[model samples]
Target chain A: MATIKVLAKCCGVSVATVSNILNNKPGASAKTRKLVLEMAEQLNYTPNIVAKNLKMQKTRSIGVIAEDMTIFSIPDIIDGITDYCQKQEYQILLTNLRLFKKYNDTYYNKDDYYELVRQEIKKLMEKQVEGIIYVAAHERVIRCIPDNLPIPAVMAYGYSKSRKIPSVVVDDVGGAAGIVKYLLDQGHKKVGVITGKTDSLHAQARLIGYQQVLYQNKILYDPGLVAEGDWTRESGYRCAGELLEKGVSAIFAMNDLMAGGVYDRVEELKQTIGEEISVAGYDDRELSGYYHPPLTTVSLPLHDIGYKASEWMIELLNGGELENAGENVCAVDCMLLIRKSVKDIT
Target chain B: MATIKVLAKCCGVSVATVSNILNNKPGASAKTRKLVLEMAEQLNYTPNIVAKNLKMQKTRSIGVIAEDMTIFSIPDIIDGITDYCQKQEYQILLTNLRLFKKYNDTYYNKDDYYELVRQEIKKLMEKQVEGIIYVAAHERVIRCIPDNLPIPAVMAYGYSKSRKIPSVVVDDVGGAAGIVKYLLDQGHKKVGVITGKTDSLHAQARLIGYQQVLYQNKILYDPGLVAEGDWTRESGYRCAGELLEKGVSAIFAMNDLMAGGVYDRVEELKQTIGEEISVAGYDDRELSGYYHPPLTTVSLPLHDIGYKASEWMIELLNGGELENAGENVCAVDCMLLIRKSVKDIT
Candidate 1:
């Protein structure tokens, strides 16, 4: 349990000297090395292998960096990494920066935590990790990634919201387009959107997709049709209330959580959902399937994406080509799970 | 990208010689080490640090062994571990056993997978993992864990379900007792339960609590009042149907997933939910609050349990006494998020 500092103090040597002896570096004298070793053994010292390995050749591990670690998307991508790594007998180091939780005054700016991330990556680099997987829960035009990363890197669940690097992402535009097209097909002239925080890249992309659909169909776009939520059911409930107050005949919730909120609020209003008002949601989360009058939602094959990213990461780790015929923008087609929520407005 | 063996071949030396030189072991002569080093440098050989570390002392990383990795409970627990370990700067090695997916055959008994588990653990051991977190998604008892583990170990989600080792679990009995008492106070006499997986410890404990409430109230415990599910919505739907067929007025689903299922099924039958048949669920998952008649379910603070478990593990890691202050059974209290899922059935 004793650290190198403690061992160094007990052996009457500098901390760096103790570190050198433990790492088997050339500078330490034989006597000092022997004395440090004996003292370290007596103290039950565990050298920071990760720190020591930085100078040595290999660590047989990779780092996975994610914006939101708790969300479903990160794990789905991790599943891919795990499967692929297991095949080639590799390991992963997972790091999460809770980007949503307010760490500094700047909202969604992970700049304060970038140093911590870089520190871990430095240890990984020290350990000489072979590769890195950068996973972001929501698409963002992040500005702080260091250019000279020490190893091969892959991005998952995000597009370069600003088009900086190649990323693997679901076809949010196509998926959103499909939903709007469906509503139009149902003869809905007044359809509205319940969306997330406005500044987000993921939300913006979805908005773009929705707008493109309306543009393609020659439908007049209305700013009154859009309402922003915090991506929670409560947000959905409040936003849907505001949208309903605007008198839209149909609503498309950007995610399942918001859709669920819409379901509860609509019921409270004594409005017979799907008959009085059509509704749809995204994410197709497991609960969406069983939502009362089950949610008509978009199903992002998160599991498949997770598995694929990890697989590709393994390929990259093995010195395989980073750019593949199927590599960039592997848009996982989102499926529309129809249930009782949407109704024919015609 | 190239391995040590490939480098050795390129350098005209035995793989052992290359490995010895790379590891900085004194066995390799200076001439051989220098030649191997020059060739490795030329070929850009980076030893796998994880692999190299495994060959040395124990990996400071710990393995989190779980039945299924994708579900809500396990992920929360793992996240808790990750959160704590990241603060303490420890690495985790995750192993998803997929135990729910049976690999049974004529040649392999249930214990066969245990051997594979052992082999995997051995790999972790060879990799030098300092400890293990055995996580069970279900309540089925397992007796296959080897007694002579080389490192510290703990169980989660359920009490060992097999051994009497240290464990961290939610207070299922107390939580269930509270829900039943609440339902009883609401004047429900003929209460029913959509029970969890038959093999689960939490399920068993919950059922006992439900029965205890009936006994305390002098209401006869009826066998027809209970139906079983595999802790999924599909199973909840089927179980609710079975229970409804037997005519229970109110139902308490073991978890939120099942409760959501019950809601969907009852709606499918053209019956008004939270009215014709009242229902409740556990876990208080995020979607529960968004249920059409927002689910009145028990909220198990799983993350709290996970955080506490990591705290305990860290304590153990630091040579702190593994003394239980009669707190080995860390029962996280569950809250009933009241919405409109259940109705008072007299």
Candidate 2:
């Protein structure tokens, strides 16, 4: 409850010196800064952000509207957003729509959900949030944010498809190419692909990555090697059976869940994952590490996407030019997690 | 941005009528109310909650300090908090202290981390949040929240151990007892137990639950059958081998990750789970469903804990008495998810 003057007097320093330390301005000596901060902590001094922000018309707060918190990718992304915001000393006003809990995976395509989002945005705007970040559960071209929004908006893990509202998403094409290249490097000539829903942006981009790697390696592209999956374990199992029967030396299931399915099918066929047929997966989910031989997969840069989105949101708030890797969309790269699943045939 | 007056004028209604409808008060004709609301929405009218709240000296916002968003338990708990807050028309000012990311698992016992929590709470208080809700990553006796806080503080998934601060935690004892009782009812006389780290409150409570069920069934408790596991899959595997060798018909691993280890050992020994050995798990994690025959586990009421914490926090804000199911603690019950992992040996 102590003011700057009281904290400074208690610490035997000038009020300006104490102010510099509290504001993290680089004017105070290290020893003096430590003394002032420790004293401030002891006195329970908290700057009234609400009163200050009201006068300045700057809340130093970002409104983060997550599609669903319970989803696998959302937490990590939110973590990234928080990490960035913490460094900037900005607080987040979180609006969890709980879409999955209410609609059970069917809410993503619903027009009514947009109305819910609009209402949340208005509520946040009423609270004087400087900007908004819409965190989607997955990658998709979701046009949820209205074009005429007063504040700057950034989309994480989904495309806004507008120049004004930038998007930060995973580089699925590059990630898929890297895994397929790794499989090819392991002396596998025939590598079968098990994809997520064909209409999915992730699936399409990953397929392109696969094709790019094959092209660079001077291998002819075979559409027959590709199997359509609805991003389910059962679908992966069915696809794995067909791929194995076709005599492919290795298989690449788009996600970790599907890779798990491939493992199940391989086990039923009385063959080990790494020995009989090399396998790879995408999305380094926690369960992937528990997979028998473990899964060689790509770890989605979900956190980076969130961080990037925050960066863009703040940049826009400050009237800075938006930095985008491609046409106002930033594609964060995924990391390759090498485990025991991929066999070195050569 | 149309004001209430402008909206009312556009809808051919009085300002009082518009204000009443907006505040959810009755007496206005349904048709007139619909016209006013629709006109308001079309004009992108947003209420200035900040200015109004400043006058009332009450912000309909709760400060949610999550230990770590990336942790499995955190997102669902936050979701529950957000769900309750949304219903109450309250917003959450989130401060995710990336404890796990910063200090890994060791941060739980660090005294310095308490300072970080205190700082965050002070910041939230400065922002004029009505109350504070601390969401822990896992259940532990975390004494991070200050004993003498200005605002009401509620602990979710952890014990605050303060009479003033109501703690909402999972009913580990009851959850453990329910699973053990199910195993006994299925004719498994020789049951084995794999416990988490001995010092954990959850592990200790669960052990007591196991003892209670055995006493209720008039079955003699065997100390030798209880194997110690550090809540790791490797520990689970090691304990499973020891318990199976001790001639136990069924094993209950304290967590799903440990239960997966039980399955690993069973497979290695060429014995099938749910048939040769009826296995059960606690913490019905998502990965449990992907287990060979899936897992019959106790689903921790993580969301329920968040919901209960929010209820108590808001109740306190409204000048209501603290309602704790136990002494300063409310233990939410865990749901038993019936899956194929548990078999009917009778």
Candidate 3:
């Protein structure tokens, strides 16, 4: 309940001096600053942030609208954003759309989704957020960016079709290629692939990476070696069974969950992972390291992407242009985590 | 940039009329209100929230400081909180502490943790958040609540030891007891227990519930049937193997993840899950229903707890007392989700 006037009176200093010391503004002597701070602490003076924000015409806050909070990967990305914001002395206004529930609802449509997102954006704007960050739960393209938002906007884990707005995304194609090249270098000639939905951009890109590696190595691109999965453990289990029937020496599941399913199937067949057959996965999730024999996987640098996205938004807010940032899209590199899942055939 | 003055001039009305219509104050005429709204929409008038907040002396914003974001359950709790806040017309300022990383660091101690939390609380207070909701990633007792916080603080999924502040927590003991009674009524006498760390309060509470059910059923309590796990799938697998050696007819793992491990071990032993051994787990996590036999588990009502916590905080913010809320702790009941994991063993 103590105000600056009370603290100033208690410290035997003028109110302006106390205010300068509290706000870290110039004109307060070091001795005055020390005395004021000590007295303020003693009196438990709380600064009036609402008045300060009004005077500054900015809240020192940004809004983050996440597509869904339940997705496993989204939290880590948020963690990265929070870390950056904390260090930069900015707060976050978060809105979780719970898009999964909306997507599952029969009555929900694209128009409704857009309307809901626009409402959230308007709400944040009304709160005087300096910038906005849209985070996608999955790796996909966002077709719309709400043309002409007054505040600077950045996209994380997804991109806009027009590429006018800045975005930070994972280099899925490069990551897949790196993993396949590692496998091929280890002499995995008959490597089978368990892919996610064929329609997915990430799945297509990963498949392309697989084929590129095989083409460069002069190995025959066998359509029979690829099996489709819908990114579930059951699908991976079934798909791995089909792949094993073809007598493939090694396998690559597009995700760690599918890789886990493949591990289960291999164990069921009395085969030891990393010994009788080699396996690798993507998205080095928490369970990947604990999987039997652990998992050789590619780590999606989602946290880095989130951090970079926040940095870019802050830059944009400070009147800096993002035009030189190469196509308005920054692709963060993925890390190859070489665990015990993959064996060296040589 | 369109202010109420511009809208008032365009609408041929006074600035007070425009302001009343905008704020939904009762003084504006119905005709003037309609005209002002139409002209405001046509002019794309966006209210200056900073100025409005300064005038009202309240921001209508709440701060949610999550202990850690990466924990699976925390997001759901946040989702619940967001849902309620949205309905109540409140905005949220979120801060994820990433305490898991700090907890794992050898240099981090209790003092550092408290100081970090205190700083976050100060940050939120400085932003003039009307109320504060401190969300813990896990269910545990918070030793300190930082005495004399300016804003009303509520604990979600955790409680302060002093009980001066209101908290919403899951009834873990009641949940465990309910599940055990359900199993016992199905004629299962020898129910093996896979518990978390013995030091955990939840683990101890669940064990007590198990013993209470056994005592009520006139069955002898056997320490040999209980196996210790560290709340991980690996630990569950190892502990289930030990429990199976004791020839128990049914098993109850402390969590769905551990139950999943038990299912895998059961399948590895060439035994049917629901028929050969009935299984039940707690915390009906996403993957529990997708497990081979579809785990029958107790659902922790985290969302309800979050909703209740927010409602209580809002009540306190409205100058309503939570005096009737016994010991400032509201324990929400957990529901038992009946699934295929538990067989009716008559």
How far out, in Å, is residue A67 in model 3? Answer: 1.4
Model 3, which residues run further than 4 Å from truth? A5-14, A24-35, A103-108, A260-275, A286-293, A323-326, B6-14, B25-35, B105-109, B233-238, B257-272, B285-294
Per-residue lDDT value at B294 in model 3: 77
User: What TM-score between 0 and 1 does chain B of candidate 2 receive?
Assistant: 0.90
lDDT of 2 by residue, A58-143 (tens): 88999999999999999999999999998998889999999987777899778889889988898899998989999999999878
Better of 1 and 2 by TM-score: 2
Tens-digit per-residue lDDT, B205-239, candidate 3? 89998999899889999999999998888788898
True contacts reproduced, candidate 2? 0.82
| Tens digit of per-residue lDDT, candidate 2, span B13-118 | 8989988999999989999889988998798787767767866888889999999998889999998999998999989999999998788778977887988998
The CA lDDT at B286 in model 2 is 86
Q: lDDT ranking from best to worst?
A: 2, 3, 1
TM-score of each: 0.72, 0.91, 0.92
Q: Return model 1's CA RMSD, one decimal.
A: 12.2
In Å, residue A191's CA in model 1 sits off its true spot by 4.6
Stretch of 10 with least lDDT, candidate 2 chain A:
A46-55
**What is the C-alpha lDDT profile of model 3 across A58-150, one tens digit per residue?**
789999999877777788899889989888998899998888876773213477788888888888888889999999887777865685777
lDDT-wise, the better of 1 and 2 is 2
